[model samples]
Target: MKAEFFTDAKPLTVSKENFGLERGPLAHVLVNAMLVSDTAKGGSLQYQVGYQLVYKPDSPGKKLPALITTPDMSSFCRLFLERGKHYLLGGMLDQNGGARVDLCSLAIPWKNVTGKQHRELLSYRCD
Candidate 1:
C-alpha cells in the first residue's frame, strides 16, 4: 500500500474534539488518493488518476459521514454523524496544545453507523 499527504480536501464547519479540557476543537482533513497500474489495457491502463478533495469534520455533538466512492467510481455513500457518537479523531499537535488534524486512514466510517449500506468503504480499505 502507498500513501501521500494531501492538503486540499474539503471539511465541514465545526470544532475538533468532542468534549475536552485540552484540544477540544477539530480542524479539517484533506485526503488525496491515487491508483496505479503496471499493465495497460482498455477499460484499464497504466492507471494514473487521482482526486483532490476538501476535508473532514469532528466537532462536538457534530459528526459527518464521508461520501466514499470506489476506485472504479461505481459506488457512492453519504453517512451522517449524530450527537453522542463514539469514534476516534486523530491529528497533529498545535503550539497551543490544540489540534491540527491529520488525515487518518482508519476510523469507524460511520459513527453509530445506521444500516449495512456503507460496508463497502471497509472493504475498499482492505484493497
Candidate 2:
C-alpha cells in the first residue's frame, strides 16, 4: 500500500467586486463545521460538512451544507480533521460554487481557536 501525504494549496483570491453582488455580503466567512462524512477516491477527497455561519464580516449567521474537496490526501491528517468534531473553518465558495476548505484555509478545532482569531476573522474586509 502507498502512504498518502498532505499538501497545502493556496486559496483562491476573492475580490469584493466579483464575489457575488455589489449589494450582497462578501463570500468569505468563518464557520463552525461538523464533519458529517469524508470519502477519498480517484486522487481526490471530499468532505460532507454541515456548517453554521459563525461570523461573516457583514451578515448574520446561517446554517448550511457544503461539500469541501482537496486533491491532497494528507490534508485529513495534516489538519487533524475528523468526523464528528466541530471545527472552526475559514471558507469561501470555489469556482464550482461549492464551499471549500483546504490546507491554506484556516481550519482548527473549535476549542483551539482563539478569541482574537475569531474577532479578526469577523472583522475582515473584502474591499
Candidate 3:
C-alpha cells in the first residue's frame, strides 16, 4: 500500500481498555521493520528483514525470520514494499514460522507511528 493512503489514517493509540477494541487481532505479529531486499520466492515475495522494532513479547525477536512473505498478486492487488523504507507491519505467522502480510494487514510507514502509538506498542500485550 502507498504511504499516501495512510496520510489521514486515525492516529495509532492504545489504552488498557481500548487496545484490542481498535486493533483486534489485526495481526499476530507487529513490528516496525525495514525492508532489506525483495526476492521472488516461488509464488510469494520474500522480503529480507533489516532493522526491526523491539516490542517485548510482540516483537518476534531475532528469530523473527530473515524474510517475511507476501502474496505476489497482480499489480493492483499486491503490496509494494520499498527496499529502504521502514514499515509498521502487522500480519499473521504461518505454521512454518514465516510471517505473511496481505493488502488487508496493518502495513503502514513507520513514520506514521506516533510517539504515543510507539509507547502503546511497546507495552502491547496479547492477553
The prediction achieving the highest TM-score against the true structure is: 3
TM-score of each: 0.20, 0.48, 0.58
Model 1 worst lDDT run, 10 consecutive residues? 42-51
lDDT of 3 by residue, 16-114 (tens): 643322221222223324443334535666666553553443333334455666667655245667776777765545444455566866676887878
| Local distance difference test scores for all models | 0.27, 0.46, 0.51
Candidate 1 vs 3: which has more lDDT: 3
| Regions of candidate 3 where Cα sits further than 4 Å from its true position | 1-42, 56-62, 75-77
lDDT of 2 at 13: 50
Whose lDDT is greatest here? 3
lDDT per residue (tens digit) for residues 1-127 in model 1: 1121222223333456522212222222233332332323312111111222212322323332222222221222212222333333333322333233222322243334445523432243311
Clashes of each: 12, 1, 0
Report lDDT (Cα) of residue 12, candidate 1: 32
lDDT of 1: 0.27
Worst 10 residues of 2 by lDDT: 1-10
lDDT of 3 at 22: 25
